[model samples]
Target: MGRSGSCLCEAITYQIPESSLMEAVCHCKNCQKQAGSAFSTLAGIKKSDFSLTGKPKLFVDKATDSGASVERYFCENCGSPIYSALPSQPDVIYLKTGTLDDTSDFNPSIHVWAATKQNWVEIDSNMPQLQKQS
Candidate 1:
């Protein structure tokens, strides 16, 4: 089935095209901070496959490691993070997986930024954990 998601307030909704790419979870410190959790789950989709129904406020944060600029889009009213786009990688968009209607099927093929992960967070032993995005 095709994937669809929306912001916390439901003001912003999006649909991933059938040909969209897979999803992944990022364990980077910046992702953790932005998500206010152990990690951030993102559905990587083509730029054209993703569309926003509402206007979201954008925040630009510089990556600590790569020094690349990451754009975080969130709901202005609810302050719920919606998605992210990196300057270094312009072809793809990382949609916040939490916003998806069905998260049961979503899985992370690899974990990035595992070095900065929280001590209490336990990751799957089978998945490849990289110190940083490779």
Candidate 2:
């Protein structure tokens, strides 16, 4: 069975593979701002394994620290973030796992852009964290 998730208003829904290539937390400032939280929970899934229902508007972010354009897709009606993809890498799509129907299995093994992580948020000492996504 496919994994399911939806936007805040349910205006947009999605189905992903039973698992993802990677699960990570992004502490980039832009991601934090977009998520309205400390960081963004991301699940990288192959483009071929991802499917969507309803129309999600796209915002192409060009001013990224990594110099890569990020195509952010979201529900226009409810303004809930859905996913993001890099123009340079079209084969992979990063879904906002916060929208997942079941998050009990959402285990993030890595943290990226930790340099910008909020000081108040303490990460587990055992997890691998990077100052940036290099």
Candidate 3:
């Protein structure tokens, strides 16, 4: 069986056929604004193993500090973020872990954009962190 997730209103549903290639947390400014939280939990999956059932609206984010465009996809009905696609990495889609039906297995092995992370947010020292994506 695959992993499944849906938007808040259940308007948008998705499935990933296998385990994620990577699990990570992003503390970038634009991700914070879009998630309305300190950070975004992400699961990176291969594009070939992903499937979506509903039409999600896309916002091309061009103001990223990384200087790479990010396509943020969300549910129009509930305004819940679903996933983000990177222009530089077309083979992967970073799913918003909060949307997953069960996140017990979600543990980020890495953290990115640590330089912009909120001071109040304490990151696990055991996990690798990057000041910026290299």
Candidate 4:
């Protein structure tokens, strides 16, 4: 079996195979705004291993610090973000870890967009940080 998750209202559900490419924290302004938090916890899962049920509304965000369009998918019923997709990496989707059924195992190996990270949120020195998306 794989890992499972759903939106706050259970309007959208998804399953990702037990393995993921990476786990990280995003401090990009857009991600922070979308998550309504200081940062967004993300898991990079391959598209082929991801399965979804229910229709999520898609918002094409054009105004971004990265100057790239981001396809933001969320549950319309509760406005809970589901995942984000980038055109540059069509085979991978950045999953919003907050929606996961169990997040105890989630550990971010890196922090991206540290340039805009909120000063109040101190990052662990042991974790690698990037000023921008790699």
Q: TM-score per candidate, in order?
A: 0.91, 0.97, 0.97, 0.97
Segments in model 1 whose C-alpha atoms lie over 4 Å from true places: 18-20
lDDT of 3 by residue, 22-112 (tens): 9999999999999999999999999989999999999999998988889999998999999999888999999999999988889799999
The residue-by-residue lDDT of candidate 4 on 1-134, one tens digit each, is: 88999999998999997777999999999999998999999999999888999999999999998899999999999999999999999999999999999998888899999999998999999889999975
Tens digits of lDDT, candidate 1, 14-124: 888644476677888888888999999887888877776999899998755657778999999887899999777788898888988887877778788888889998888
Model 4 score (lDDT): 0.93
Whole-model lDDT values for every prediction: 0.83, 0.92, 0.93, 0.93
lDDT of 2 at 38: 95
Q: Kindly report which residue pairs in candidate 3 clash with one another.
A: none
Candidate 2 achieves a global lDDT of 0.92
Provide the lDDT at 114 for model 2: 93
| lDDT of model 1, residue 133 | 72
Which stretches in model 4 have alpha-carbon errors above 4 Å?
none
Question: Residue 111 in candidate 1 has what lDDT?
Answer: 80
